[model samples]
Target: MVDFQEFCKHLPFGLLIVNYKGEIIYKSQICENLLNNSDPNIKHIQDILPDSSIIKVIKEGKFDISPYKLKEEMYLIQIALEPGKLGGILFIPEGVIQDIINASPRVLELKHELESIMNLSGELVTISDSNGIILRVNNACEQIVGVKEHDLIGKSVYEMEKSGVITSSSTKYVLEKKQKVTMKQTTKSGRRLMVDGYPIFNNDGSLNKVINISKDVTEISILKKRLEETKNLLDYYQKELYVFQKSEQEIVYQSKAMEKLYDLACRIADVDATIFLHGETGVGKEVLARTIHNLSNRKDAPFIKVNCGAIPESIMESELFGYSKGTFTGGHKEGKKGLALAAHKGTLFLDEIGELPLNLQAKLLQLLQEKQFTPLGSTSPVQVDVRFITATNRNLEEMVREGSFREDLYYRLYVIPIAVPSLAERKEDIPFLINYFAEKYSHKYNHYKTFHPEVIQLFVDHKWKGNVRELQNTVERLILTVPSSQIEMHHLPDKLINTKTKVRGNMNLKQAMEQFEKQILIQTLETSATMREASKKLGVDASTITRKVKKYGINIAKLQFLL
Candidate 1:
């Protein structure tokens, strides 16, 4: 008396007939958007969502569904038990309507694209009606919210928050305005998301729906919050490393330009001269300044940083110089010690020096010339021993020529100019820097970190718009969420990875030598299982083999003799 086709007709979405185990025995209609180019298979629900949890519900004959945001593709799938048939419909979201447009099986771009999306990790996606009703939700959202996706749909936006107040008022505003909105939100799943709520407009210019794309930024937020703490920790570790590890001064530097920069920074570190650091953002000005300080006579003293760009012009002077009691509004009853005094025996780093107002510039020039500065409301000239390290991405030389900056102060600060080369200018340092940070943050974050050879080339090939900061961020990003034990070239960010997708295969003279070495080492190792044997076979000295092995981290002991 139970009709199988009649049972499927009761479901709202596309129905697929399945066996007793809920495998896709037969699909009544192919989910064109999801399986349009390929045949449907009986696999785990993660085939549609990278982090979906759908198998548990259908196997138990209970209702299960989850939203999946696979990169550029979005899907809302639902599955409920049927008595006669094993499976039910898989309701995909409306945007997947594009998957229905393929006329032939000549291409599989959509298939691969959806597959890629179904594999990416650490992402959240959702779709809602004009009323902000939950029409769809992804597994990431479920994991984040600690609830199943089916339970989420048909639940009004009102009953969900339960705080009785509509959270993310921006989402409401976006739906009303029918415009895209990007902002930060904390999900019910206890994670921070950089959410982008994009409103889908109907042809009539009315609000049809909104798609909320989100990225989990919990790790990034933690890293950003502990940025200053991480600095202290890194400084402590680096200093400790110097004590326990022997200093390889020559190894500390490999690039000639870097060596020249270090030489210039070291020469001016001991003296209390105003050293101007000129480099693109992320070229490691602060690190260089600290290194200079560490190598200087004032290694024992603190190196204070004044982020001029972050401070307002009105209070910039007050912050740079000390303030006496009752000198200005909100002044400490006990006079505050300015940075100049705070760094009495060490270095003071002024970042974004070009932004310092002209008035304050004059005062700074006076202090630099007079070798002392009186605190606000006090006449006594408080002189102290402090080294000045100023850095800027702007061309101070141009600013002076344009009359925006004081020439006298410019000349004073330019006394010991040290230009930090951008990562592109001296790309040989990219690999070294990547390895150092990978090792450093691997221990710091407790994450497994290793680099592939192609990954190194990708780093070297990047435009590095943010400079070393950009590269460091890219490295940190890889270490945090790259779901692999080893970092391959493909695991790098799309921007960096794409740059090398069509790289020229030509290697210059040095590259040829390296490849020759690689071939010799590979053949030697394959023929013999000992470095001694491989070296003896190749007619090279064993010490040379050892040096090359150390340089490349190759296991010489496993190598064999070659012809």
Candidate 2:
């Protein structure tokens, strides 16, 4: 039989023999090479391997195994008692430790349990190396990533991304960032996925592996898109409904000019700026101001209207700013809340703003700028929150030049000036207005009536100097005074009918003749059923009548109702 030392030398491991006192008695040449020392006699085992388990093995006299590191290499240190129980023998085997552990029953059972748990998870899980090479994937990979485990395993993430298997790779980002990463990705099968990647690091703080988990968000994404579309459609229909309601309840017009003006008003209704309305005496500026107030955030609050021209100069200040008790003999016992205070947190419409007294403009300016005012016979300033909407038919700039208006107040009110179009400017809306007023007053006076085509034609041809007010007043008069159900030409005021034949003194004979010819054509078209009939009645060709109608800019559609 070979001796112990010679036998240990031929073994595929380093060997050492320590006595009961923990001193090394024998060591193989392999052990000397591993420890980097040739002499070992009389040296304690602790001196060679400071963290060794030789002393415990000697005391127990049992076989044991542990992991040990010498320099950068790892070894499995197996310790056992020597013969006669005098010492302990240590076997340091190079490599093959992992193979031994994997072959063990307990380790194999634990590995199978971990793999089962990973496979049963609902989220898609994948393990890849630092180089983006896929190592393992769970069963959820097929449902989420649209790829089977066998197809994805052992493949490079970079290669799969280039082939359109996935839109992007979270593992690649994890390797680059050396930390956790999350991102949205799309698969070749049109699945949207939210993926999270966790990186595993080595003992030296280097990236070792990346574990990725993904969730399917395809249905959620589609639902989110559909919800956005539905919300947009609802907003569009809501705006249309609002416009329809406004047209019925307030201002009525079918002209493009009015449409554009109302669109601008609605757009700026929410803003808290001082608006100045400029128009003729009866172009409906007050109505527009009220519409703005109704559309604003303060619709629930009070809307106070003050006609600056209607208030007497002697009592204007007291009426607008209120007066303390006993300020005058005729005053009420208690102090009063003025119109400005009554309009708190709401709108204050100042019609005929140009008619405001020159001295009072300064106080009005103070209220507008500071939102506070001094009541009559009171020393304290009363606070208010009022939105000012001023309207005037007179030229404010001319008044400013004439020293009748304050320049500062003009600028403050001129912040947002809207020029309301006159009825003559938007003549296309006249017919609709006439019909609306006719129906309105006929119901009011309990008389069901209509207007003859000739009467409507004369009304359209007449210039309405007072704008909508004049037209509305004329319609109301016709509905009330006319006894017949159909209002005829004789019922109209002479001024309106005379407009058809009245010639300005400034016109030459040829101009007057052309005007006369235009009137004749209009009258004939109103009586005839067609252009051919009108031409026959006038002794001219139908083409010549058509050319003359075009030259005169006649609206034949308006006359179609008569035919």
Candidate 3:
């Protein structure tokens, strides 16, 4: 792709055409590069360089020369606007003054065009000697500085410093660096001036003449300060948008219900509050809770997961609240920190918090309220800063009403409640889930079999009452039994693909097919107790049902006895 912006990058030495009224309507080849070292075509010169000398030359019809240096090279670039002609001149320093005379025809032509013109005027034109003495200045210099340039021509440029510009080591530094410096210099006239100190050097790189170009900046400086404040505000908003983008992409979803949940999760991840996850077994509740933790402010801190369902009710208390070395039988000899302590300075995800016995719920509630907990048999209380996120399939609200769960604990965990929808509601996502499970099991058992479209649809259409766990088990079974390169619809359990529609509202398309499939498989198996006879009854190859039975997670032991 051709980028015109690339061309704008080469415009340090530039020219322009302007009307008598001082508005610049056109700039030459190097104008864009001079402004930003980037795209040159962006309109509006004031926006590009708010304090522009382009306007000054056009208004006053001035012949202006500003000395500048870049990368060890000196330049005496001159700008001139002639009367009656709208065109301008850009006399660029060609390496050294002598180099311009011997350069290409294009350079020679431009030099001739600029030198032929005369009678240029501007606000101020200053010429200084090699020793930093003011050598000459035009009549406008008197009006601007409130002093006749002729009276100060022989004096050192440093002597006119009574108007708010106090020279520092910065002046010496610019000379030593041999670079252009922009600074404020007060003239003897008590006028505040915004100035640029330009250094001019000869072909031998010796100091020649240094010129100072200045403009009154009392108003412009105030606007610049305001602009800085707005930029700071934009930077903060940009950071917030970045966080939102990262969180949105991290939420992986294959189902609509989950998709909505993910969007909601991203919105509130940064908020300061406890969150609770509720879902059935094997639905990745803990994983979701951890995701919230990783997205929150405390991401760099620890993320501790304690599965209350997995621990014995008796020791659950001791495990959560640290125990003294000899507090109980079988306690750690050196005393162990509890799960709460281990989770300090980060998130503590209490999985299956509902299973925490009612007697212990009070203690958990107390810790949440005070943000502190005492280790079992340790009289001293331990204070810690921790964010608690709990997950449970059991309905804490229902248990509270039944008096089996603590009401106080229930409210504490339900601050930001999120319900992970059941798999049945996301049946539209069954196809994706099937593929994921199939791939996982195939890799686990070192067996590979691709599924036919019809076979996969059978899995998708089936009512997954057992949700993801049951679905995973079914995939593992199919991987073990199916021998063909592809699994077919008949390979699915007859109860799913062959079932009668008579199965009440409990039956989706999958359950109906499954019932019909099972009847055909059993009848065929009993007819000859042979795959050949079974495949014939089901109108498929004997190898197909062998795969179907495994994939459907059917108990073949019962079928064999009946056969």
> lDDT score of model 3?
0.66
Of 2 and 3, the candidate ranking higher by lDDT: 2
By TM-score, the candidates rank as 2, 1, 3
lDDT of model 1 at residue 398? 95
Runs in model 2 with CA error above 4 Å? 1-138, 146-215, 241-247, 261-419, 493-563
By lDDT rank, best first, the candidates go: 2, 1, 3
Scored by TM-score, the top model is 2
Each model's lDDT comes to 0.69, 0.82, 0.66
Candidate 3 residue-wise lDDT, 177-252, digit = tens: 6877777755455555666667888999987777655676645667788889887566446434543452243233
Model 2, 1-563: lDDT tens digits are 88877777787667777777777777887778777987636388877887776677667766666667775355645355663244554544545566778889999999898789887768788999989999988888888777889999999999999999999999989988888999999999999989999999989998889999898889999999999999767745644565667435657876678888888877777688999999998999998898888777778899899999999998889889998877878678897879999999999999999999999999999999999999998999999999999999999999999999999999999999999999888765676688889988988899988986555655666799999999999999989999999997677777876784562545555665576568667766766778788889789998999899999998999877232
Lowest summed lDDT window (length 10), candidate 1: 243-252
| Most lDDT-accurate candidate | 2
List candidate 1 stretches off by more than 4 Å: 1-252, 504-563
Query: In candidate 2, which residue pairs get closer than 3 Å at backbone N, Cα or C atoms, i.e. clash?
Result: none
Residue 181 in model 2: lDDT:
92
Candidates 1 and 3, the one with greater lDDT: 1
